[model samples]
Target: MNELVLTLGWLGIYAPMALGAASSAIGCAIAGQASIGAMTETEGGYGRFIGVSAFPSTMVIYGIVIMFTLNRDVTPENAGGLFGIGILSGIALMYCGIWQGRACAAAINATKEKPEIFGLSLAPAAIIEGFGVFAFVFALVISAGIS
Candidate 1:
């Protein structure tokens, strides 16, 4: 069982980056689709739409950072903590990325209709990003105590 636990510990160490990449891909795709549609409809403000679509990519960066932070010797003593924190934080990042993408898509659509409200439309996506930040910060904080 020690081997199994160590294996899980390794899995946990890398899970954040893997899951965060997946999240970024899904989120970017969703927002990209919306941006593409908006671009075809509106001639101006294509840059903003495209820019917004990239917002979800931050999750991967967060994941990479978390993965680095979590990197260390995996022993039975701390494996459980590593697994729990890494996996849970990864899930949180994934959730945030996916929802943030949808939010960005919504913002794009809204801005497409009323360009004046472009800034306001991004509020939801920003809020979602804030949650991701919270997860990232907390993960770092918690991981510091794991050892």
Candidate 2:
């Protein structure tokens, strides 16, 4: 019983990180697509600013996750060592959600104006943002020591 508990406990710790990785990867893809779509809709120059604005923060979050994971020995057993994971994860999720919402709105608005380039702006970002939510949940669960 003790061994089983320990194993499950360890899983609870590591699973969040794994989920986070998957989520961020997908989210990035969506953000990338949104950026491209926005640029295309705005005649190239206008949408570039949005991408530029989003890029720095996105990179920072990515850097933090990588730097922390690299510097610290993260494992299922040593789960709670990096206490900042939950906070960072939450921020990342929120950022992605907001970004996706904006991208969706942009796409919808663009579609209304010119219905030809319809699905470009919204779908990718929405899909990727879902992964961000997953990452947030994973981080929350791991931080809380809940499987």
Candidate 3:
């Protein structure tokens, strides 16, 4: 059982990064597709579309930081803490990334239609990013208390 627990602890350490990266990849792809479509329709300001598409990529960076924090000794005493923090944070980040991507896509599409509302259109995506930040910050705080 010790060996199994240790293995799980290691798994927990890496899960955040894996899940986060996958989430970010999907999110970025979704937004990128919208940006590509918008680019074809717009005459200028292609840079804003490209910039908005990258909004979801920050989730992966949060995951990487969580992974590093959790990569310490995987003893049975703290394995459960590692598992809980890693898995929960990973799920939060994953969902946030995906939804944020959708939000960014919507923003891009809306802005392409009415360039005047470009900044306003990004409100939803920005709110989604805020949630991701909350998860990331909470994970860091929780991880510190694990040991």
TM-score of each: 0.98, 0.39, 0.97
Each candidate structure's count of clashing pairs: 0, 0, 0
Candidate 3 wrong stretches, greater than 4 Å = none
RMSD of 1: 0.6
lDDT of each: 0.95, 0.48, 0.91
| Candidate scoring better on TM-score of 1 and 2 | 1
Ranking by lDDT: 1, 3, 2
Q: How many backbone clashes does candidate 2 have?
A: 0
Model 2: per-residue Cα lDDT over 51-92, one tens digit each: 432432342354345333433334454434333454455456
lDDT by residue (tens digit), candidate 3, 122-143: 9998998899889889999989
Candidate 1 wrongly placed segments (more than 4 Å): none
Writing each residue's lDDT as its tens digit, candidate 1 over 1-147 gives: 999999989888998899999999999999999999999899798999999999999999999999999999999999999999899999999999999999999999999989999999999999999999999999999999988
TM-score of 1: 0.98
